[model samples]
Target: MGNKSSSQPPMKWPQMPWTDRLLLSLVTRLRDVTCHHNGTVNRRLFPFLDHCTAANPNPVEGVCTSDITIDSSCNLYVRVFMPSDPSIQGRPIPVIVYFHGGGFSFFSSSSPPYDALCRRISREICAVVVSVDYRLAPEHKYPAAYDDGINVLRFLDSDRLGSIETVTDLQLDFGNCFLAGDSAGGNIVHHVARRWAASTRDWKKVQLAGAILLQPFFGGEERTESDIRLDGAPIISMERADWAWKSFLPEGANRNHEAAHVFDSIKAGIEEAFPPALVVVGGFDPLHDWQLRYYEALKEKGKEVRLVEYPDAIHAFYLFPKHNDNTKLMEEMKGFVQANRSI
Candidate 1:
């Protein structure tokens, strides 16, 4: 945790319109009902949520969908979204392999927010968006999800494989690739980035444009003041986060493992030849301070980095298109991608 300042404003949710408030209440009710009966959500929720997203369409153009299988058994599925028109000609378009957030235990590729956001990013950034549906916890734990993430990238960058089910066949500009994720997915992106950095030969063939982390969860045993303050906030509570973390890690595995927390172990290596990074955090999120620390560490290494903090936002604010701040964040992301197009 970073040093606290008394001058920092207290974290709290800002006022919302009645309609938005009602929708949030309904979502909470539905989430509680589903969790109560099923214990946790299954992959089926993805298609259903996709339908919801399709109904409430956003201002995105060119939406193409396909699945990629990381493992041969076809158990693991990775969904992808590509722009209708080729955004980059003569070269493979820059690709963003996105990992969806659900504490690494909940949600699927079909979640409304995930589907809509993936489509929006594809259209907004004009890059192919690959959403990895890595195996979840209790049944499959740490390193499993991480391994699947690495394999997915390997498969996409492969030139030999004729075709693979569950994985897409889109031509990718492997040289200009970016790893991105939210929440637990953010943790996966960070892990993959470290691995990519270490495996220079493999990653060198492909340019790692940068990493975009949205409310990443870099875990540690000790709780920061922000975590203590936002212990029971709506959307993502501390208790839920704790449960998710425990569920993701294997039995008796230290939560602070280099592969688990990442920042501590890979900080030095990350500082050396790391790709540029953009980290976005909600001002009211418990992980805000941690994101700031990560940003500072990258800057200390003289790495190109950008940080955006939304003052009136909470965790997962970017997933909610209804929020004005969320819309602005999308625009900012588009500009960031445009300006940072890998050379």
Candidate 2:
């Protein structure tokens, strides 16, 4: 574990553009930015800000985006993006299964920001991006999202995905599939990857290549240095996180629940089956220590783990294009996918 002390050396934080600084200041004023009320989300109240975007199959410059239903029973769907970049068109492309972050209770895969992020990944990483639209909480609760995550994997391995028109013509390399998410979605990636590793289904075509977790939402019963010091910081706070946990976790479950605190309950054997992992940590994120803990836990279990740190980053810095770290992240991700892809 890294040092969890009160006093630390001064580290340079990223300089945000003026507009981003104003937006951050404004967001801090909200009780909880993503419409948390009465233990459930009220998307209607913030419809303008939290609006969804319809998927379009029509190619726009270098890529194409469309929606595919995964499971109608649970209202699960995914926004699929295929790269049309000249360099990638002729070759078989890797697939990335993405989950969006909204503290678990909010944000769908089709949310405008998430949609935009996936498009860039598809174009720059030269891979197909399947951003999963899992059910949310205070209603669906824990395991619902995790279950949805794994179900998407199953769908990819099955015959159904191949028949979809948007994906049919494109050469998708499922054998090199990677799971990625940020914040709460990052938490989901861990559980889903672990579950897939344990599944008895001997996958002959689909292989879990790598897990890309960006500042994964993780917690414990006790607070760490980042949690204590970064409290009330813009974007994320301890109070808001606690409420999210209360809303998402099963009734009466605390922060130490298996979903939130992964370091304690990990059993043997899963690590060997688990794919190589790349965990990204932001120096300014309150969850920094927890993300580090995740990397350390994986390393301790004899798993191949890579930790990428941005000393000047805040939580979800990848969302806004104004931050230079966001650009760096894309390049880092592009490199990871290229290096970890199946032969």
Candidate 3:
């Protein structure tokens, strides 16, 4: 693991654009206040700043959302969303299991940005969406979030939702399921799908349709060209990205760990093991090369995949669903789902 010291030199946000400087200042303040010497995050202020929390009300119109506790023991939970589109009232639509991104240490299923995104997805696609609130790192660490993801799939396959009075009236077609996430959440989607594909354990009730990774967070010890090229890019600077990995990855695990580097999967033919995928890359984002490399590797492995690049966009564009780039992304997502959905 990289050094865990919190005494590193102060960030040089003044050199960045005013907007980017403000963004960096706000995030740094939050981290300074919530994070401890041991690297755990408190994050009580996130909901207020992001506009919601697990306890906050759902503000998106045309979508009905409810909370579910998949494992009471660990407080593992998820938020279920269904579109209010009357046309699809009794129709069984595809199910999308979504994971939100915050470098694996922050954010939740209820964070306003993701809430808005999921709301748009369910409303537009007329599908059932499950927003997972996976445990974060430093406190929960790697594999914990991955395990919660896998268990959610297990819960679905157990037919347990049939007993939940809240979701009983909803029509969810399990046979058409997809995994998706942005940044760190995208990393989770990859791992969860890998686990599902490699395991004999059956989630036979649901078919894994595809994976949609938007600006997936990946890293390695060997720095790539883009990492240096966009060293201090807005939202995700090289320093910030390195800190996130160091803070989240398991102790003693370096950037080259399979969990952080998707290329390791290629050796075992695991890229082929993954479901068909749509990988979205932001033109100016620091992680662009890593994301592109993963996409190219998948194609080389002969796995069905597509690449979409927003040449002028930056990281986490999907936070604003109405933005032109994000709108294109959502449309692409809907098309991918419709194409692969079980008939």
**Candidate maximizing lDDT:** 2
Task: For each candidate, give its TM-score against the true structure.
Answer: 0.83, 0.91, 0.87
Q: List lDDT for all candidates, in order.
A: 0.70, 0.82, 0.78
As for candidate 3, its clashing pairs are: none
Candidate scoring better on TM-score of 1 and 2: 2
Off by over 4 Å in 3: 1-38, 42-59, 163-165, 271-273
Q: Residue 138: error of model 1 in Å? A: 2.3
What lDDT does model 1 reach? 0.70
Q: Write the per-residue lDDT of candidate 1 for residues 137-209, one digit (tens) a residue.
A: 7468778888888877777667533453123345666677788899888888878877777776764345577
Q: Residue by residue across 215-235, what tens digits does model 3's lDDT show?
A: 999989877777776665656
**Which is the winner by lDDT between candidate 2 and candidate 3?**
2
Task: Write candidate 2's Cα lDDT for 1-343 as tens digits.
Answer: 3443557645555689997786556444333655555677665655666567778777775778878888888889888988766666556889899999988877788776788889898888988898999998878998899999988888888878765534636778888999999999999999999888887366656788899999999998788989877774667878778888888999989999999999876644454678899999988998999999999888888889899999888988887768878888999999999999867
Q: For model 3, what is the alpha-carbon lDDT of residue 42?
A: 67
Evaluated against the true structure, the overall lDDT of model 3 is: 0.78
Candidate 2, superposed: residue stretches over 4 Å from native? 1-14, 22-38, 165-168, 267-269
The stretch of ten residues in a row with the least summed lDDT in candidate 2 is 26-35
Clashes of each: 8, 0, 0
